[model samples]
Target chain A: MRASAESNGGGADDDAAQVMGDGRHARHVTLKDVAELAGVSVSTVSLVMNEKKNARIAVKTQERVNRAIRELHYRPNALAQNLVTGTSKFIGLLTDSIATTPFAGQIIHGAQDRAWKQGYVLLIVNTEGNEDIERQAIRMFLEYKVHGILYSTWYHHEITLPQSLKDMNTVLVNCYSDTENLISVVPDEFNGGRTAAKMLLEQGHRRVAFINTTVESPARTGRLAGYRRALAEQGIAEDPSLIVDAEPTQEGGRAVAEVIRASGATGVCCHNDRVAMGLYDALRNRGIMVPSDISVVGFDDQEVIAAHMLPPLSTVALPHYELGASGVDAVLAPPVHLDDHRVLIACPAVHRESISALD
Target chain B: MRASAESNGGGADDDAAQVMGDGRHARHVTLKDVAELAGVSVSTVSLVMNEKKNARIAVKTQERVNRAIRELHYRPNALAQNLVTGTSKFIGLLTDSIATTPFAGQIIHGAQDRAWKQGYVLLIVNTEGNEDIERQAIRMFLEYKVHGILYSTWYHHEITLPQSLKDMNTVLVNCYSDTENLISVVPDEFNGGRTAAKMLLEQGHRRVAFINTTVESPARTGRLAGYRRALAEQGIAEDPSLIVDAEPTQEGGRAVAEVIRASGATGVCCHNDRVAMGLYDALRNRGIMVPSDISVVGFDDQEVIAAHMLPPLSTVALPHYELGASGVDAVLAPPVHLDDHRVLIACPAVHRESISALD
Candidate 1:
């Protein structure tokens, strides 16, 4: 295949020489080099490097090997060690476009911190939704003997597990399989939706509007159900007119502004922060004010938008960080049974200046 | 160290058993197993797996080995293969908080795509700015014998190289070292600033106010110089009153709203998209319409905010994706002389509704 313009490098043969060539990498300081310097056998140096307890090597000899290693700056080959130990202190994270999402950083941050504490390191591969790359990545992970694998997605949805993942110890994050085949961790979308409504309801807005997304997914279905449940708990009838469908974007929010204002709802719960931002623009254009004119609450309190909005939108968090951390926890702990493995982390509400109490 | 709340798993002892234990991982189907199934010796299986040229193995025996591998679902151990070949197809990406930045997704995406095309896999570790973790990650990458290392930051600036990175085939991305010790790739800050100014100047705006960041950094100095150069090219004098410093945030832009209006400039250039968004809000509240009253441009065309803004922002793109892809290219290519290895990728101007002719 022709290389992309950005690669801008020479052909494979040019790469072949430089792949292990003299220019980029200096000759690696190896175990034998250290062994020769320390006047010890290769195995003696290995035993010392591994800190093999009860090895019959003399203390003076061990000190000499350690000194030689420091002098030569030799790094023990982890691959060779993995071959002997049959295990690795690495967890492979294969994600479908998470690295491309704005808030994916939180997920990676949580997982990396948790993995680091447990004396393991996460090796992440963002597959960018390519099935071929995903397969190749999983195979590579297996070849490296990763302690476990975390198969994740950018958002919450149902996914079809790749056939290659069947035998590996894999946990699904932010996405699950219908076959009940893998342990999964995802956000509690239902509660998150309920949280948005409850925030508005607690401010004494009886006639609340839910600007639901038109797209069909777990978030759309689950959040709507949770909204209805919150209304039922408040002893209010579900008003079909107040529940309007939008595209779940800034434009979608702007498009539904007239419908929301005409419905006479004092407060509105948006599908997401982007939708809320659009509504803010539409409302500003129409000379309507937030809180005093119409209270608004958004879901997925995206930090860049939610916290930086004109009124600092009150919204529910997606628990993306928890989903990642839990994915790591699940993989490292004793395996949960396939039938009882779906774990849901709760989304919490964040109060800002967007909502106000009614008289 | 005590484990954090997120890692609600048992102690390391419990992890030890499960690390290579019965519950999570199935015993790997080894080369010996494949050889036994094929009724051939282990060396024959190895030779077939590697596709060694001029091997004396019979065609029938090779077919048997291949069939056994397919039947047993055996994945050739890449680590073991690396041990024999003394080369690896892995590149290590060590980042300081890039995963947490909003537009950092683009950088990782570009790098991953380029690396994949070259038959190399990227093993990314977001260090999150912890010095200890950064050192450990570098050591781990060294131990794994990664082909090269890409040390990246979320944004452009100068960085102190970690002591552990001194020996690796390392390339700095979106950052440069003060000592000129390594090859680096960064966004052309001066050109990016020039592009932002030229976009406004081309639209028949002579008096353009530049809202620069207050933070002392390359961006602050370079962009300002570029802005001056654009004005000089147009035979316009640099007006001291029109140049102002802000905190590079929405609030900062809002804080300078009155000053911008008072300066009588026909057009404005913002420090970034967030600042422009803030200025938009402030201008709206004061009954000033964008483009109609005063044209505006922003830097860092942050897609989520810039495209979704009321009037999609006209701004300069940061070339983050190029920085990452080029970092990979730099490491993979023959190393350039240290004194002449700083590569600057240009930031292009993106036109949108926010900019209009001054007339």
Candidate 2:
């Protein structure tokens, strides 16, 4: 609150007086003022503003109201319009790490793009992983009567639903509810893992290793499952030793290089791009060349890391933008009766230069 | 429009009917409904809802109106309240790349943090560097009558003012206006550059190279100037050859291996952490050890790149979050007279292992 202390001019009591106390302008412009200017009823002005011509006010009268609005710069109160129409052109984006993660901008862009196309604006609230903040944000969203709450997390994870969310039309993004029945949009981590493994396998990498996160993550688990499934389909016996765990970072990728070399794996599928970056370093340090000597693939095709890779990393795109856009689409769309509104967008293969086909 | 097609249920007309047509509910809750429930005039209900107790309205009548509101679950129209109050409790964040850049999330977080503590919500608009989008966003912000507009850029750059923003209270974050008089909150890039160079100079390195972006950038130019100034201060003649240009990425950093080798500079100040990541690779490739052989410093200490470096990277922090938070604070606070309302925040030095003192 101290942060905004200077912004505090007058509290609630001074609001009305301030509206009428503009000495230079005499008073703030309002719908009533516009109505008086146009010589029309308050309801007639509201009808013209809402574009609700169903009651059919004369065109001449409507034009006069419009002229008065422009002359006075009298913008209608969007909040009041929502009250009469039962429509709040605001979608609440309640996120834990949307404002902290590298991929955050993409998700928000997608959500904003979708919301605006529908004449709605996004109300963003970053809770920074505080349960109390999240609870309070939900309450605030309810008070504003947001059309829906887009509950998004920075990364893919499970979450405890805020009790306030239960009473609202809430959509989960990059996360899921504890119990089913809630709508969710999340990336297909398993598919991404399979895609990474398959890319290496198609490049004649029979001995492929997967270096993944040491931390227990759904992405890690799901990716591993897909990796195993992809290998199984190729009639390769499951070699659990080929799968190793690291911190899911550049250091983690580097740490697992010895294991990869010891296992005699000719190719590697990293958990994500950061891990792949480390692998590139570790391999280069050991004088192990990429593609020719060992091929590499990664998940989450982060443009900054993957594009800047020496040969450009071939990885699975996380589809975070699609997740946010589709999540908004799903929630804002007409209600569908699904067993559970769980939609998984694909993490498609982004084949760049890292993999080479063996003769 | 196609994006929100499903969410669009008969536009404005369907709103009132949708509430009343729920079948389970025979009539929608409205002011008339509340007034009837309380046995009071509609104006009395309005005065009560607005809390305009003016001493004329009896205490008993006010209590009846309050009970009716709770019983009917009547939510006051926020837009109307805003119209009366001249307070929207909403701030517009007009950004070109908040949803695209890796550092953007930090900026949004800081802005959101500052806004919320003051009971305001951020309405995000990612213009994606489109002029039309930017113009439209500005108009929308004006229509909503946002408390203030936080016009931000993905990177540091100069932008032409949008015509729609001509009459609005707007603050620039991470950028500035062409002329004075506009309030701006931006990171001191020159200071950041100086910090990077100073860190290397303090480590007893006389010969220092600055690897900067090939493409023109405020950061690249500012950092180069600081690098030159630092060398000149030590009476080390500014060697034009010591200033190398690259793509301002890892690949670009890696490509400068031969120049670094030939220049004989024992210390380097990279434009950013990504460039530093590349240098680490190029140096390691040639068996040139960091710090022991050549100390390195960088700007924009990106956590993923700087923290994950083999020895970690010492760099100057960008302070993007502060730019956003303070930008909001500046705009929301009472106006102060200045040649230009420019507030520069310091980009402090961050020490890591990439730099070392010479024995």
Task: List each candidate's DockQ score.
Answer: 0.42, 0.43
At residue A119, give the lDDT of candidate 2: 82
TM-score of each: 0.88, 0.90
Clashing pairs in 1: none
Name the weakest run of 10 consecutive residues (lDDT summed) in model 1 chain B.
Answer: B1-10
Candidate 1 stretches with Cα past 4 Å from truth are A1-25, A31-72, A334-340, B1-25, B31-72, B334-340
Residue lDDT tens for model 1, A130-207: 888888888788888788888899888899898878767788999988785578898888888888899988989999
lDDT of 2 by residue, B206-267 (tens): 88888888877677677677777777788889888888888778888888877988999988
Scoring only the A-chain of each prediction against the true A-chain gives TM-scores of 0.87, 0.86
Which model scores highest in DockQ?
2
lDDT, candidates in the order shown:
0.82, 0.77
Docking tier of model 1: it is: acceptable
Tens-digit lDDT string for candidate 1 (B110-168): 88878877877787788778888888888788778787889899878889999767756
With a 3 Å backbone cut-off (N, CA, C), the pairs that clash in candidate 2 are A79-B79, A80-B79, A80-B80, A105-B99
